[model samples]
Target: MTKRNTKAKQLILNLLKAAKSALSQDILQAQLGDAVDRVTIYRVLNSFLEDGVVHKIVGDDGKQYFACCKNCSDKKYQHNHFHFRCISCGKIECLPNEVEVKLPKAYRTLNFNGVVSGYCSNC
Candidate 1:
């Protein structure tokens, strides 16, 4: 029972890789119906997070979004990326981890989340 043999996991990984943006469990379940149970999707996502195969972030809407982590390993995401949330369609995209935003000294920062909201190119 090696993890590599799990069909559901492979399906999820492929789905995330093909996605242009992060995906929620709701959306994942919709894309993969009868083949994989809804509960399995959630479990696989959790496992991926723990295994550092994918990264999860809480969106501005307070919902969890999962995206594949090609740049992550050993339980840490080596790159820092931003989330572009489209206000028009409510679609959130994971941008490349290259943009750096300097925070002002006056603002005490605890956690940094670069989530910018605006209309996407498709909109």
Candidate 2:
């Protein structure tokens, strides 16, 4: 993997670290001020995603939101945490549950990927 140094990546990471909720590409670009172009920010996000430095989740609006990894140290990209999508506010919140998911024996026969999302308590 080629390492590239760009302000956009740094800014994006910082924003993700600071944000409490999921962020879309538009919001990230707005928060980045004038430090990076829209295309550059998107590219940076994609690169980080490919490097396993970040994870993307799909919202109810059919838009992808990026969030920092829960197990960033180990570089695990599994969606072990449940996603809470506020029906009223349309915000995707990450619930604070450090649980690991184990698939059933039946699922082992077939390759299974798990994802959990629903209306949050705040809704």
C-alpha lDDT score of every prediction, in listed order: 0.80, 0.72
Among all candidates shown, the one with the greatest lDDT: 1
Q: How far out, in Å, is residue 69 in model 1?
A: 0.7
TM-score, structure 1 vs. true? 0.78
Candidate 1 residue spans exceeding 4 A from truth: 1-4, 98-112
Kindly list the per-residue Cα lDDT of model 2 for residues 6-52, writing each as its tens digit: 66678889998888888889898888778888898788888877777
Residue pair clashes in candidate 1: none
lDDT per residue for candidate 1 within 93-119, as digits (tens), equals 778666555778786444446688888
lDDT for model 1 comes to: 0.80
Would you estimate the TM-scores of all the predictions? Answer: 0.78, 0.73
- Best of the candidates, TM-score: 1
Model 1, C-alpha of 1: deviation from truth (Å) = 9.7
Please give me the total number of clashing residue pairs in predicted model 1.
0
Q: How far is candidate 1 from the true structure (C-alpha RMSD, Å)?
A: 3.9
